[model samples]
Target chain A: MATEGEGSGFAIHPMDQFVIKPLFGGEHVHWYTISNVTLWMALAVLCIVLLLVVGTAKRSIIPSRVQSVAELVYGFIYNMVEEVTGHDGVKYFPYVMTLFLFILFSNLLGLLPMSFATTSHVAVTVVLALMVFVGVTVLGFMRKGVGFLGMFWVSSAPLALRPILALIEVISYFVRPVSHSIRLAGNILAGHAVIKVIAGFATLVVASPFVVGAVGAIYGLELLVAVVQAYVFTILTCVYLRDAVGDAHH
Target chain B: MATGTETAAEAAGHGGGHAVGMPQLDFSTWPHQIFWLLVTLVVIYLVLTRLALPRIGGVLAERSGIITKDIAIADDLKQKALKAERAYNDALAQARADAARIVAEARAAIQADLDAATARADAQIMAKAAESEGRISEIRAGALDAVTEVAQDTAHEIVAALGGKADAGSITAAVAARLKE
Candidate 1:
């Protein structure tokens, strides 16, 4: 791709930014290798710590700036879990909060110059989505026994159409993880890649101003996307969890 | 030209690991990315579950609890204030009623005293008038007797001057009859 772009009178290797490279300078990437992924992930962890742990060290009834942010995020995710999954699903709050904060911080950090976006990769998002998927499935079985399969049965459907609806329900149920993971990975990947491609045009002196303005606009949009994607991912997890722990009224 | 050659050389060297298509599909780096991602997720999970979530949750709960308690206290204070105002109003009414009663009692006492004084003055005036009436009647009776005697003496002198004998018994009887008339 770089060579092709070189032939086209411009050098733009947009995918280069997503390349995995060791931090200490080496050609090899091992499972134990410390890479840019580690650094950015560590930064996210630090941000979480600063906002959640140290910011609230005083336990003040009136919160400081960082403490209030921490409290807002907590209440936001906690209420989401409680409302979507109902009261019983409140136990999974920590898991949902973990994913939300990690994705939210990663997406925002990736917007910085020369920063790597961890959530843009399929591997990371796949693990996250699968965790929610497997957990909800297992919890459904545990809580409802064989009754969990009844979700796909669609008892409200007419008897003649019940089988077809059940088949559709089952297929959609299995597709959740794929759609869940791809939705997040695709959004981040596309946004970052678009920005890179637009920035590549800035190499020309004439287009630099417009490129800068466009990139700025996209950056603002990406910021909204970052928070929104995180919210969507968490709320979807809560919705899936509701199938497991929610009442049988549906 | 030299830098371009070096960059090409570097790219050639990394050809073993470089992604020809999307870096996201680079099969060789999957293990490395997956491992780091797992570590990150685990660390985040532990940090949140063990530290962050509980603290934030506690702070939120405590804040709401404090707010509810404060509201309760404010309500209690309002009730107390209302009670105090009612007590103050009741005391004011009681004082006003007492003042009116005291004024009425004082007015009644003053009216009784004034009536007694008027009665005593009237009795004294009546007694003085009666005693003056007795003295006046006594003086009138004495004057009548003196007038009769004077009349008798004058009559006797008139007869003597006319060269007629004057009898004391007839003159006395005539004076007496004249006085009676």
Candidate 2:
């Protein structure tokens, strides 16, 4: 696999596409400089605007195709937040919908022939998971004061084990953001990498058709993962918010 | 398992210039990724909060309102139609009863007229019979008078012709006694 710049070798470079090179020629990536990541994220935003805002501009009772799509998205995110978080959690529906839509659009768009999968990066997903983590923590403290610390305490456990159980619970509680972000990034990254690896073998004429067919199968699975990951993230956020706002259960 | 392969492939290549590791672990690109992600997500959040969600909510509320109004109108119309139907049936029954009463009244009036006509006809028939009986009785009386007068005159004529004395009072008495015997 270490065949760098070896002219006659048929080596595959899957990570080359993920390099954060500037869109302009010969310029290194800067904080403000536009890059492929900036372009794609903007595109995701554009898509969200088109689907959610522009699509429903007409507000027709008998919805057109775009309107139907907009309504379905609206109802889906709305119902999910309402059901998972309950009435108190419903106030944060827009934030949850925004998170769900952004991730969903990014995952779907990342599947393009040549595009960046932003959600596949830890930098992006960790920020999102941190936002949820920090927001829920702050809300819990604000609403319940010192009682919020009771979240880590296992009250029903035997007194001898409660101290040890609380330590584990606190550690696990802090690890939520790490696992949450990693789960999404890992799923997206692996699916795309497998497809690219399989597609690189397409240059060989003997196994090209079979490999390409397998790529297609993987593509179908990736599509499923794309939507499912978004749903998982949003539902987890709701569950955490419910825990933060709801009565203590454990 | 899959990340190992991806990282291994990345690590094996490009030893001199910017060695690629696990992309998720690559610290160089984190700032770029995080900056753009924050910008994009914040804009998206604002769009949903200020524009999209509200617009969709309005459409839903408007549709529900229109449906409720239409249902209310339909219910009102149904009640009105039911009331009209009830009134029409009642009027129809009243008209039938009225028609029956009119037929009975007409029949009774006709019976009374027929009875009056029959009574008038019976009175006329009784008067005509009584008048005929009176005329017959008068004619019998006249015939009886004529027979008595003729018998007396004949007896007087016969007595004179036979050369015997004719007495008017004695002839009358003898005729009457012979007629009685």
Candidate 3:
């Protein structure tokens, strides 16, 4: 009376890492680690490099299909930069375009079975976030110098509370990178982990086709989540870049 | 401070949870960052500044050349039309001059013919006048003789009717009367 292939099912924690390390770590440090997350990151970079190289190799009056696609991506990023940062934003087009392409490729790569979502890892996300934070902070100082510090305070508040407000502003500024990294990692980790849990249930429950169908539907929904998360990350990066260059109220 | 080997051993046993504890600001990552950033920046700059912009500029230049060439052709056509009009006007003027010359020549020829006809008429009149002069004198003499005869006849008839004297003085009077008539 029992259905086949029914068991409690093997559970996998979303934080699991498959590490690959070398023998020595001295002057000529021969060390390499291949984790699920790192694998997807490397793949994303490769994809982006290939796209850039192949798309622009042949410069023609009348563009080929690949060239047009590259142009479209360029135009899209250009407009996005212009809209957020106004006229001065065009100078940052290259950075914004790279960010979009990298995150988009990484997200898509993670969608593959057994592939790690690098963005889901706090370390990787933190690195990217910190890079933005440091870059923006340096830019602000370079552009405005000592005056840039005033960006945190001197809002429409009363002059009496300016000191307290400035302290609060400093704290908020420090939290920026942490929040940015956590937002990306949390969304990706939750989605992938939910899918994994549902899939595991589907494997364990052989008697109910309904349960399997439900899990399949959730998996399909996860695909949409993956793309949405990538878009959100890119857009947020753009917003941050705009704030970095423009008025601090952003 | 755990050695590299200890960290790996710990990572293996704990499933790589060591990455979550505290982030070590690895100086090694800086080289990678700088290298990648420079590579990206240079490649993008070369593509946009060198390749794409130049191609777009060439297309614009070629279009300008075509438009200027078209204008030149139009100007040339206009000049040719003006030249043709001038030639047509010159040919018409020549034809008008030729017509005026032919008309003047025809008028002169007609005038010469009229002068010759007038001269011929004057010569005929002179010749006729000379020939008619002698005939006219002979006619006058004959007429005078006929008048004397008629008078003598008439006087004789009258004297015979009257039966008075028939003298020389009466006869002379009768001759004078007949001449008067």
Candidate 4:
């Protein structure tokens, strides 16, 4: 039997990465690069497509259990949209539901042994954030024209302080996507790093079953955090979309 | 110099200077933000346009159709009920008119019967009065004949008691003398 460190240290752990230059070598890439993250994202998208197609292929007056579950999910998202964005929010229900389901599944997939957590990468998260940011901005402008600019200004504040308030508001509005992206990436990366460090330490200590058990418990906890983080990200996206389309006063 | 010192420390710990641990953050390899941004936008756009929006629209349309059909069925039932109510009222009015005609006819028949009975009773009373008048006249004639017979018998007895050949004036004088003595 091979010792613990004998077989290339657990076969490189799949997602573990180090910087390397290609043979042609104008640029360098990490072991777990953007290409890997893109592949996983595509996989997650495919999973969602398969889920929807399979869930809704058969239509029945009294639905089968699978179809009922699918309808329940649809209703849950619809109610959430209505709660956050009122009745008009229903039009955007599909986009919001897909975003939620895709991210949730991706996060769960990452929890499997040797699976890559694509959400841990800042680039991928940033792209998701930027999409939301641009989408809302476009919708705002399309709905309200030049008046969309007034969302940052023309608050219920007194006229004398309007300029100063508007400046702060504009800066905050610009920071929305950055904060959104960073919050998700930071949480995922930190959680994974901690688990990795603990597991590494666990290997060093022998005759300490307690330590191993504790680490196992923490791993379970990390799975819960994964789901929660996905939910939080999707809910925040909905709130931002609501602000973009709805009246600012509300 | 710092790199040399780190390599020396690693070599002292192990036979070689191969660092084996988690990698440090390298922000330099970050992708151009615009490229990823465009990719995400396109993905979101496609998702909304191709999949999400159509499903939501189908659900809403199905729900609307159900509601409209329910309303139409409700309206049809209401119209039927209204027609039934109108027909019932018409039947009730016709019944009332028939009842009134029957009542009037019964009252007229009773009035005619009473007038005919009153005429018959008056004729019976007139016939009884004429029979009673004829019985009263016969009884008066019988009483007058009895009075005449009694007067003739008294006159004969008085003549037999006086004498055999005595005239009426002598007998009258003799009877007066006998009474005076």
Best by TM-score: 1
Candidate 2 - CAPRI tier? acceptable
How do the residues B30-148 of candidate 4 rate in per-residue lDDT, one tens digit apiece? Answer: 45222433454456447645764455446545766877998999999999999999999999999999999999999999989988988887788778777777877777766655544
lDDT for each residue of candidate 3 in B89-170, tens digit (9 for 90 to 100): 9999999999999999989998899889879888887788777877787888888887787777778778878995787677
Looking at candidate 4 chain B, the ten consecutive residues that score lowest on lDDT are B15-24
Q: Is candidate 1 or candidate 2 better by lDDT?
A: 1
Q: DockQ, in order, for the candidates? A: 0.32, 0.26, 0.03, 0.04
- RMSD per candidate (Å) reads 6.9, 8.1, 14.1, 12.4
lDDT of 2 at B69: 97
lDDT: the better of candidates 2 and 4: 2
Decreasing lDDT order of the candidates: 1, 2, 4, 3
Q: Which residue ranges in model 1 land beyond 4 Å of their true spot?
A: A1-9, B1-19, B111-181
Superposed model 2: Cα runs more than 4 Å off: A1-11, B1-19, B103-181
| lDDT-superior candidate, 1 or 4 | 1
Identify the runs in model 4 with alpha carbons over 4 angstroms from their true place: A1-35, A206-208, B1-181
Error of 3 at A193 (Å): 1.2
DockQ of 3: 0.03
lDDT tens per residue, model 4, A43-101? 66666555554555554444567656656666777778888876777788767876776
Please state the error at residue B176 of candidate 1 in Å.
29
1 against 4, candidate with superior TM-score? 1
In candidate 1, the residue pairs with backbone N, CA or C atoms under 3 Å apart (3 or more residues apart, or in different chains) clash, namely none
**C-alpha displacement of A76 in model 1, angstroms?**
0.8
